[model samples]
Target: MSLRTRLQGRFQLMAAALVTVVQLPPVLWLCWLTRTPLPALAALGVSWPYLKQLQSPWTTTPRAPSTYVALGWWSACLVFDVLMLPALLAIRAGTPADATWGLAGAVALLLGGDAVLGRPRLRRRTVRIAGLPPELDGYRIGQLSDVHCGPHVPEEKVAGWVSRLNGLGLDLVTVTGDLITHGSSHVEAVARALGGLRAKDGAYVSMGNHDYFTDGEQLVRELERNGLHVLRNRGVVVRRGEARLYVAGVDDTWTSRHDLSRALAARPEGSPTVLLAHDPDLFPQAVERGVELTLSGHTHGGQLGVPGIRRLSLARVITEWTAGLYRRGRSWLYVNRGAGTTGPPVRLGAPPELAVITLRRE
Candidate 1:
């Protein structure tokens, strides 16, 4: 293995060890204080799936229902520690045993319900583009990103999303990336589900980091076979009577295939353009190129947040462009919160989203 890969593996191991150290001690102490082995056993049970993930990390696809439950439980415990640990320390007085369980239960139920039942909801936005063609004005495009169709997200769910998108009567549909989580196992299923999507133009897709993780070429073939256009550093023009709208997509930034110049090379001069990039970090570049609208989704809106104030999300620590609309002069970027979960399959404040964006001439 390369030195960088080795270092990353070692770092992952250390991080997993740290998580175990931080999370287990409190649960074990509580179990000891209560003189009950049940909580301790439950903790271990919930942690097993997560531990397996650390062991194999990239290869093990979490498919079991119990695995999801365990993951949810583990996430709840982490949240509990973050919220209660400080309060427990400040009080000095021992917390009632029942209260501890009650709080844990409540956290688990809330987080679990949000993760399991909080389906993607449609969010509508209107963007005014400078010098947009009259025929292209009010062009509605549906966007989906980070669908992550795998163990946590089933084909049926994707089918439902397609049905909903189809009902919207969009002019076009675009999926930003992260179509599959781990392997080729669910690629066909997701492709087939997404194929049901219908629009006046067509559906376009860009690659994401996770898509490259498992047989990206195969996934592309499957998606294309199902009638979705997979844009890899390419642009295409769609016509509405006399007006032309240019839509372009580049491969994911992480995999080193993102060539913005190549993607835009074929663009007709002065044609209003929309760029489909999986990472919103490319927004600056898109702006420099004067791309009218950029659509992306990799943050998953931090997958956790406060409802009204999503800026407080933990995802902010990772990226300044965490979610929602961003504008720089005439260029605009919209970051979808994503339609599925990744690591723990749990969402707190940030719900899954399907965005319907309409373009208006400024």
Candidate 2:
């Protein structure tokens, strides 16, 4: 077998082992307390199919649409199982088991059901840049990111997003990496799907950490071949009438070298520039460089957020600018929640987004 296949097998085994370690114990403990294996068996039955599906190579096969839903529910079970651990402990201390189980089940059902219902949505944000060129005012840029196209996220899903993007009549399109989950194996297919995207200045992409894991160079080449421009520490001048806007893209800071200075070095002083960097962590660097706007992805808006919490997402733990818009001085940043998922094949409050950013002169 190939090295990748061997690695895949080992990873699957490791994941299965980890899941068992986390999930099997609670079920077993509950069973031991209740003197029955039914609960444990039921939990295993609910989660087994998803674990089985994980063994398959993500890039090699097309998954059934329902596979994502099943996996989402399975993920909810795992999450609730963990969340209920404290209550389970309380059960030993005289708390009622019925109430604990009911609450856990209810929360899990709501969370998982919400994820399945999270349709890809177009979120429109208008950014007012203080130094934005008058001619570039009302410029609509379509931004997409973190399209983890593979088994869990099928081609049809991506095609649908592309169709939506085509309807926007955008001036420019930018995709901020994580194009595929696995590697170069699915690059062509993803390229083909993304090839449908068209804009006035065409589509521009910056590599992400996952893209690096999936063979970054090959991904860049495939995207370029499919007519999507790969911006690797490079700058392009986009013109509208007599107005000029400099667009630059940096390599992923998580897995690759990123030189914001190099990417924006050649741009004329005080000209409006948009920087495409994969991670939002690099927004400070872009701001320092006087980039008018920076676009990023990779957080997926944390994929889960508490319902009543305002502007709170799981991504907040890792990134300050998880989703939507944030401003620093004269520079602005917009984080796209992404079009696809990586691990659980689900999204909770943070739905998949096709962000339409309209630039306005302040």
Candidate 3:
């Protein structure tokens, strides 16, 4: 091979190896950490690095999309270990002990129990939001978030969700990014699946971090082609009779390229505006700009639990307003539990959710 060709091949190999390391090594350590009654010290040693690895989703050479949901389970198992080990160890050892048999037991339960019993659950929520205006009261907006469509996400399930969204009789349907996993891989399929969803105003979306990681622009067009009106750093005014509701969306903040200012730049004055941001962290900017309602779905509401042992899961850290409606002074933020899973395909306390949100002038 020529020198340049050899160099190119080497680059490909390195990239492939890095992806595999990111996706596989922690998983092996996690299995070992939970398989035995490891001490607290060993527990910590095994888990800390796994925690870091979860943030990077690539595994294998060039990160091939697995046909099964094993990675998703693997991801959730690690999260479970993080929450369960510390407490169970503290209880079993009668104090905060080092990685010991007790600690290992807890870690194992988190990893194994969820793997065995956990099922992907979906929740449909409807809320009649009050206190908008006479004209804008009773505006129904269907919200779908975090539909990370790819390998493990059953194709029929996705198409079903879109059908359900359409049945809600919504004035508008909004997606807050994460519509697909490998954005270019199955986003077009997702678009086709969602081709049935129709709302009066339109369908809108904001880009999520995962979408940016994959192919974002193509995903956007695919959704548009499916008749879902997606918005990215843009706004559109919808008129329901005499009422006007300005809907805008901001790109994900974690990817560090979100421009909130631009997203709301075209927001209409004297209109009840709703911001559809993929990540809840953008609420501050929305509140500062006097946005009324902001919808989000990045956190999965502590995806798993041990039934009363842990109050909530570590998924909470991904968003301050993890999985509920919170009012930041004059602005309201509703973080959806999400329509799909990220790493682990299992969900526990926080069920995957779709929302039929209505706006009313209180």
Candidate 4:
């Protein structure tokens, strides 16, 4: 095999081993504390269908049963680490056990409910752009990102998102990558479902890191075949009466296919522009390029957050521009929390989002 392929294989093995190590200890501890093997046995039973995923994280299709088990296990572990463990420590330190357990239970239930039952909601935001053409001032764009369609995220869910976006009467629609979870198996189905998106200027897409995990080229072809424009380091211009708007997209940055300079090379100078990049880390570069607005969605808003706080999320550890809107100078960035899930198929405080952004003249 090629060196790159070999390296990828080795990396997947290491990741699988790491996840196994991290996930095993909590279950073992639970069994020990409970003085029974039932917990351990039950964990094994639930994980059995997904055992192949441990060794090959990117190869297996996620099913509902395994998906639920994975979500439940992740929630349990999170509760244990964040709440249960602390409560147990307090109980050992002469604290009242009743109060501690009660609080832990309440918080756990709240978190669990939000993770499993929360649905994607519509988010509306208006961006003021300097030099925006009067004709283009009220331009509306609908964004759906990271809709990881596969076994876990069914095609039906994607179709529903498309229907909702269509109802918004957007001028343009953009999907900022992570179109499928891993393999090429679901690419056609996802593309077909997303084909239902309706907009005056049509839908545009950008590649994300996860899209490259399998056959990135095939995904691109499928998306294009279904009438979606996959912008790979390129752009297109749309006109609104006398005004012109330039829309462009670059490939996934993680795979090094992104070429911001090339993507913007064909743009008419000083024309209002919007860029679709999968990773928000490219925001700084986009701002430097004078992009009026950059849309992105790779962080998934950390897939968890505090209810009242938008900035506080697990994604903050990876990026300051975790979710929502960010600005620097005259440029703006809006990172969608995405319309689907990956890994455990669970969402908490940071629910999935379908963003309808309106651009107005400054």
Taking the candidates one at a time, how many backbone clashes does each contain? Answer: 0, 1, 23, 0
Q: After superposition, how far is residue 110 of candidate 2 from its true place, in Å?
A: 3.4
User: What stretches of model 1 exceed 4 Å from their correct place?
Assistant: 1-45, 57-62, 65-69, 78-117
Ranking of all candidate structures by their TM-score, best first: 4, 1, 2, 3
**Residue 49 deviation, candidate 4, in Å?**
5.5
All candidates' lDDT scores? Answer: 0.82, 0.78, 0.66, 0.82
Score every model by TM-score. 0.84, 0.79, 0.69, 0.85
Model 3 residue 203 CA deviation in Å: 1.2
* Residue-level lDDT tens digits of model 3 in 1-362: 75435534544554344334333544556567688534334434444443443343422112333312335434544454455546555675655445465666565555543433233334444434455667666777888878887765756777788888887688888888777765356767777886677887777777887676456777778778877777778888888777678888887675566788887888777777889898888888888998988998887665554433334655554555767677867688888767787654665556567787777655
1-362, model 4: which lDDT tens digit per residue? 86456646765664455346435768788889999998778876766566556454356454666756766786666545445555665566675766677667657644653665356789999999988989998899999999998777889889999999999899999999999887777889999998888899999999998788678888888888889999999999988898889999999887689999999998998798999999999999998889989999998887766654667777886688988998899999999999887666666667888999999989
Pick by TM-score: 2 or 3, better one: 2
lDDT string for model 1 (1-362, tens) is 86436534764675465457446766876788899988778777776756666553346454677666766666656566545654554445456765566566555545643544367878999999988889988999999999998887899998999999999999999999999876778889999999888999999999998787677899999999999999999999999998888899999787588999999998998899999999999999999999999999999887766655768876786688988999999999999999997766777667889999999989
**Best-performing candidate as measured by TM-score:** 4
Winner by TM-score between candidate 4 and candidate 1: 4
Query: Native-vs-model 4 lDDT?
Result: 0.82
